[model samples]
Target: MLLITCPECGARPETEFVCGGETHITRPGPFAEVPADVWAGYLFHQANPRGKLRERWRHQAGCGLWFNLVRDTVTHEITSVYRMGDPKPEIA
Candidate 1:
């Protein structure tokens, strides 16, 4: 299992956290103006890239804070973890 490090807490087991799916998802738009297809895409579509990807994760069994993590999908190597509002870091 992965040993994810929380910004607030120290390194913890992957079982203590929960993956919240892909990060940086842009909302389609104002609900009243967005078309049905676009809205559906925003709600259902996700980029399951095979290489490096940014994802949202929560420390469910610990401090219970949300954060962003950059990890390699193929290798499961986490390069960095940052807070929710921080800009995404450049990872080679």
Candidate 2:
């Protein structure tokens, strides 16, 4: 099982967290100004890469806080984890 480290709590098993999906996804500028296609793209588009990727995970069983982590989609090797609003890490 994946051992994810929560910012509020300590390390926990993957079962305690929910994989929210890929990170770095921004909401289209403003709700009212966004076009239908653009808004739909923003809501439905997601990257399904095989290598290193950044994703969001929530500690559902622990602190209930959301955070981001850089992990490999192929091997599931996590490189780093950070808070929600923090600057994106340089994934190498």
Q: Which stretches in model 1 have alpha-carbon errors above 4 Å?
A: none
Clashing pairs in 1: none
Each model's backbone clash number: 0, 0
List CA RMSD, all candidates.
1.1, 1.2
Give the CA lDDT, 0 to 100, for residue 19 in model 2.
94
> Counting only residues 3 or more apart in sequence or on different chains, how many pairs clash (N, Cα, C under 3 Å) in candidate 1?
0
lDDT for model 2, on a 0 to 1 scale? 0.91
| C-alpha positional error of residue 84 in candidate 2 after TM-score superposition, expressed in Å | 1.8
Model 2: CA > 4 A from native: none
lDDT of 1 by residue, 1-92 (tens): 78999999989999999999989888877789999999888878888888889999999999999999999999999999999999998856
Candidate 1, residue 28: the lDDT equals: 73
**What does candidate 2's lDDT look like per residue over 1-92, in tens digits?**
98999989978999999999999988888788998999888778788888999999999998899999999999998889999999999976
